[model samples]
Target: MGVVAAERIKLTSTRSPWWCAALVIVLGLGIGILMAVLSNDTEATQGTDPFILSATTATGGVSGFGVMIVMIMAALTVTTEYRFGVIRTTFQAIPNRAKVISVKAAVVAVVAAVVVAIAAFGAFFLAKGIAGSGPTIRMGLDEATWRVLYGVVLYAALAAVLAVAVGALLRQTAAAIALVVLWPLVIEQLFLLFGDIGKDIYVWLPFANINHFLSAHGSTTADFHWGPWGGLVYFVVFTAIVFAISLGLVNKRDA
Candidate 1:
């Protein structure tokens, strides 16, 4: 309990997290508004009835760039401490290095989850309201819709844990941020360029599976062995493995 409070104070004392959070809210809501406006224009131009806004489409910004920012913030929480040698003091005070890291991960994950939940739902309803009324745009809370809304919150929390692990392992801000941001946005997508083999490998990529889970329908064309829940499980296991490795190294290595 003391460790958790200390971690929370350390996190909130920094300005980067707050800035990152603000950026997330802006991206989530701003992009949602843009998507809605564009969709409205498309419907108007086509002379068609208003299009049904899929939850996936509505919350694209939140789950996409917004979550990435959250991961970067989470990574920075650890890397900045190492950069300034604050981690050594923290370790000295706590003595249980694993507990400190675990508590930090938990604190960041909880904060990330809460912020993203608000942004996700805000983006969804804001988009729905802006897109206006139509028979198809009933804003129904169907199973798929609910999944897209909540899946982002789950993804953000897990991704924060992964980012914290990466930060602790690397202990360099730039490298940790690059790996977390690029792995999902760039490296994962690069696999698609490899044609059939890439498609097959893509089915197993962590972010790909996460996207599959968050999607209203599965996001990827690659054949996954499991369904959405299974994809989530795979991601959870992957994150836990990475986090465990970080714990081992942090305990064995110098602060």
Candidate 2:
């Protein structure tokens, strides 16, 4: 508990976490507002899909910026210590490198969850207002909408963990962040850039797999099904592989 508190203090003392979080909220709201204002006349028909539209509407803003901020926050959290040559002291103070990692991951998970939920809520309501009262999208109403919201929050936290994982593996913020962000934008996008026939490929990428599966709106592709957990095992497997790599590097590398 004490160690967690101390680690939390380090995060709070720095401007990066708060600032990055704020940026996420702003970007989410901005995109939501844009979509809402542009399609204010869109009406939800009785037979129409409300969750689908709402999910696509709000997440369009977070798709790019949120990933970038997650990488930045994760990189800064670990690399900032390296930059200050304070990692050695951090190691000495904590003595349990794994626990330190856990604390860092926890801080990220909690903060990301809260901030993302807020962003989702804000975006939903903003879009609701601008969407002109035909129907309002609220959180926790249906399985699909709530599932996507939960997944978004989880994705944000996972991005943070990914940041820390990459940071531990590489030990440089620049390289870590580049690898994290670039992999999705350049490498992963290459999978779906072909379009139409890329459904199988789209269902396999890291973010794509999770977001595409959870997204009721078909943001990534109009093909993925929101029914049944297609490959929950696959998600667990990938997360485990990445996490193991992080643990290995952190244990072997010199502080």
Considering every candidate listed, which one attains the maximal lDDT? Answer: 1
Model 2 off-target regions past 4 Å?
41-52, 133-140, 194-201, 217-228, 231-233
lDDT of 1 by residue, 85-117 (tens): 999999999999999999999999999999888
lDDT of 2 by residue, 88-195 (tens): 998898888888877887787688778877887677677767665444443334777666666667667777777777787788878887888788778877776687
Write down the RMSD of candidate 1 (Cα, Å). 2.2
The TM-scores, one per candidate, come to 0.94, 0.84
Local distance difference test, per candidate? 0.89, 0.71
RMSD of 2: 3.9
Report RMSD (Å) for each prediction in the order shown.
2.2, 3.9
Give the per-residue Cα lDDT of candidate 2 at 188: 74
| Model 2, total clashes | 0
For residue 109, model 2's alpha carbon misses the true position, in angstroms, by 1.5
